[model samples]
Target: MNPMIRSTRLALAALLLTALAGCGDKTSPQTASSRAPSLSTVVVKPETAHREQVWDGVVEAVNEVTLTAQTNARVLELPYDVGDTVAKGDVLVRFTDIEQKSVRRAAQAQIASAQANFRNAEAQYKRIAEVFSKGLVARSDLDQARMQRDAAQAALHAARAQYSEAGQQVDYTVIRAPYAGIITHRYVHVGEAVQAGPPSPQPLIGLESLKDLRVTVQVPQSAVDAIRNHHHAEIMLGDGKRLAASKVIVFPYADPKTHTFNVRLLLDGSHASLYPGMTVKVAFAVGAAQRLLVPVAALWHQGEMTGVYVVQGDSVRLMQVRVGERFGSRVEVVSGLAPNQHVATDPAAAARYLSSERAEPKA
Candidate 1:
């Protein structure tokens, strides 16, 4: 081969090798610090954190019942509807009481007859006893009079009981509130036929006492001891407001199936719309100690895994974290984060950076 031709071929191969090496260096993945992307950061300031175990719970009424019909009757009158507040003994529903009233009147008449017979028997027995003692009447006559008086007294007693029962029947016709409560639902209107108990004639009304409210939390058995010994606790509303629990009632036994104990916490009476069935959060005091805190927005959620981007001197790394009870906009770092470290405030931006870094070409 010619010397000039061989030299040209070698020179061309060297240039191609150089270009490939340069391209590889340009496309290779690099650390975040190498790019030095500008990012908003938050300085971690550890505060006196309250360590609590938060459990999702629901607001419940202290007294709630679906008032049922006591006797099969057509609803004669419905005085209240849903959302009506009623006091104890307030008539909520009135049924036709014609039969009950008639029975009561008959019982009253029987009482009247029994009383008259009893009086006559008493007077006769007294007269016979006196005469018998004076030897003016035979002993058999006295015995007969005594038996008649006793029979009259027994009749009177029966009559009284029948009358009382009849009165109750009449009273049952008028359904009244057992306690002061707000009517949440009314299942019957006037003229609706309501059946008697057991297969309780479709509930007449649903009543609940909201003034006396409580939170029932089914706590895991593992946290039973903590709840039992809970020195202090607070309930967090959906809006992030915290209110202290008036009392805590930890049930002694745990459910066999779920292995959870019922923990009842009473709420302070409020006129607000903190209604029953609202989902709330309960934070039972496990312990009180200082810990790192971060804004909830700073925490990145990756499926089930949660993390935060810790930025140190322009170098950012995704750090896994365990978050505890939320405090306003911030949350307690249970672990994986330290005090005085800066983290990206915008988790979305941090996540984007992480994604980009991952998308870089691999050697």
Candidate 2:
């Protein structure tokens, strides 16, 4: 055999062996570090969570009223319309005052006449009493003058009362808001006829205060006793906002039809963007429990899929989780996840890391 041919065969055989070794390395399993890149993560652990009985509640204003017509008049001016905010003592409606003013003036005139008659009767009685004391006039004349003076005094009192009442009637023609609130409804319009009386007075306007708000919940009879004893609750609003109730009120009697008792939760101060007739969830603290909690930001969603990027040693994988009630920034993982397992806190960062890892060439 030639030496050059042997050397060339040996070189070719070494090249083939090297190629086969490279292919075998590609089929081997990847280590933990090679599967996922580094990311900020948190450990899943159990926390003390409050166990609550949640019920649907309706929001209502603490100070709400409907202004009704107190006197017969034609509505001349309506200064406010529905959805208008009003200050205390602001004029809401103004009615024609011609009839009321005329009555007031007549009563004033009557008062003046009554005052003059009473003055004259008093003067006459004094003169008659002095004359009778001096034995210059009969006793009957003195007695009659005294009686006339008393009657005149009584008539003057009646006239004054009538004048005051007439003034009140005139005041009733102009309606004013009793407190600061939003006008929810305007039942009477400008130039509308409003009557006050027997069957039912005409509703003029409706007002509700937004500053002081309360949530009304119809609780079942079984839960009423517990709620009454506890008297602690929180109102759940949109955007994950929770408000604590300042006070709780439970009605003694239950509804005849539903067998539910009325429970009211009064909010402390002004409610942020809360309005009447809004449905909210009220959670009453009943007990406590241990729950596996993870930051809400860790949860990932893709169409119908929901899971978290769980970190195992140096590797991170998406694990589907069954979540229960949400507690502020954290959520309870009911199942599909175990305690002490680390999860990526920043889901976007984890996703990016995973993408980069998958795109890299395998070792």
Candidate 3:
């Protein structure tokens, strides 16, 4: 080969090698930046969390009553049925009032007759007293007129009492709701005979006020002490809503048969929309403990595996974690996560970053 040609080939090969090295240096920074991208992360720490003890409970109305008949009569009109909402003073039941009306009228007539007789007797007694004072009549005759007047006055008093009692009976014939509530059950239909007596009063209807609600829980004997002492609880509704109890009433006595105490948790007026007889979860705050917490958005669920992206320097890794109760936006980390570890706030972005990093070829 010629010396000049050999020199030119060598020079061209060296230039090509130098250009390839320069391009590699420029692309290396982009690859490094893509592998270790910035991610939003939070430092895991222990928080003061309440250890809740949950149990099944039943909902009941605070103001519930079973109305019974107070007057003997046949059912005439039943304007309201079960599940019907009623306002205060609304007529609930109307009985056949024919007999009651007749008795009331008779009492009114008796009162009138008694009044007329008393007025005549009073006039006679006044005339007799005047005559006796003027020495025109005997003392015995005046005394007899005074006695007759007193008897007529007594009869008038008795008649007035009878009239009042008769009116009360008429009022009892039309039963009205004592408070605004919803009808739960109807014991009698129209045209049924109900009696008001000593043996067992007939129950007419069942009503419950929705505004005041309570959660009744039969707590086991072992947990009674803690529940009674803390006196703090929450009602877990079906839709994942939680309501704090306004008041906690632990019954003093435990059931003799079951040996469990009755706990009543009163709910505030805000939850009036809840219906009665609903099963709810009652979470009683038994004690407090330190627990690791992270945002629920950071969790990655794949089949049965639950994990989170933990940021380690410039790399993100998925670590399986045992989760406890959910506290609003954050969740309890029972295990697998340590304190002060940086956790990626967004799992999806961390996952993408990890995928891209793994796909890159090794230098």
Candidate 4:
């Protein structure tokens, strides 16, 4: 092993290491340049807007009445069924009144008999008084005659009162509608007996006016204050039509179980298609506060997270957001967003732009 020969071998080894390092650097640059550039995207300018709160509700008739029987009797006939339209004073039901009629007739006969007895007693009393005045009868006899006449008059008056009471009982057999409306329910059927007074099962006949419809909504305790203060809201139908409502009446009491207040809205006009118990979506404008809003196309929803893409300096950045009320084709951004920011309308193109930016090397 000569010294000069060993030194030459070391030099060659160092030269080989330098050549390998140069080759590695050259391969890295080529690999980076081979990646594609990111694509461009369209941007949308989001605006600051106010959002409304929507609540679910049900439609009902403003005027509703329940009919009940006043006396206990077998139902003889029911002229109308459920869903039947009835006018005021229309006969809705009829009970068997034959026995009542017979009682009335008996009362009338008693009145007549009493009246005849009163006439006879009156004539006898007058004749006796005349005799007494002419000295033909004593004072005691005249007094007895007068007493008989007074008793007959009292009997006649009692009989008359009995007849009137019997007549009223007979009238109760026929049930009539109190107002013009459609019959929503019929609790009694033919031959069904109904009892009067409390604790007795009473018949229920439901009536409602379809001309005026109303909606009742339950507002959460959190939103009750808003409803009480503003009293302005909007109703959205299934078909996407919105009705503006400025009148909202809040029930003073809140439900103990739900802790929500009941609110009723009077519809402006009669909605023919609307029926009682129909579910609807209601939106109430509690306060006018500005927030950020964007179109639905600009939003991207993933599992448990919602976000949008904003174009910034030739690249797109993903932004998480909290959504609020929806106004037609637009939605309110409750948080994680700012006004006047340019968001990418197309999410796919925006993603491509982001990926390309990451792939590019520093200038």
Using TM-score as the measure, which candidate wins?
A: 3
Q: Per-prediction TM-score, please?
A: 0.63, 0.72, 0.74, 0.57
lDDT tens readout by residue for model 3, 1-363: 899987787677555433322312324311223345688999999888777899999999889999999999999999999999999899999999999999999999999999999999999999999999999999999999999999999999999999999999999999999899999999999999999987988999999988888999999989988887788998876554578899999999989999999999988758854788998888998888899989988998754457787776655566778897777667788998999999889989876775576567766
Candidate 3: C-alpha lDDT: 0.84
lDDT (tens digit, per residue) of candidate 2 on 113-149:
9999999999999999999999999999999999999
Model 1: lDDT equals 0.80
Q: Each prediction's Cα RMSD?
A: 14.9, 13.1, 14.2, 17.7
Scored against the true structure, residue 346 in model 2 reaches a CA lDDT of: 90
Model 4 bad stretches (over 4 Å): 1-51, 120-154, 239-247, 289-363
TM-score of candidate 4 on Cα atoms, chains taken together: 0.57
Instruction: Give the runs in model 3 whose Cα sits over 4 Å from its true position.
Output: 1-45, 138-140, 292-323, 327-363
Per-residue lDDT of model 1, residues 36-146, tens digit only: 667799888768755688898788888999988776678898889888899999999999988879999999999999999999999999999999999998999999999
After superposing all C-alphas onto the true structure, candidate 4 shows an RMSD in angstroms of 17.7
Model 4 per-residue lDDT tens digits across residues 1-363: 798987776666545333322312313221122333343334334554434688899989888888888766789988899989999899988998887788899999999999999999999999999989999889999999999999999999999999998898788889888778899989988988778768864865888877777899998989888778778777776654466654789999999998999999988863666778789888887777765667777877654457777655433456667887666666677887766667667767665554454466666
Clashes per candidate, residues 3 or more apart or on different chains: 0, 0, 0, 0
lDDT of 4 at 353: 52
Q: Local error of candidate 3 at 341, Å?
A: 6.7
What clash count does candidate 1 reach?
Answer: 0
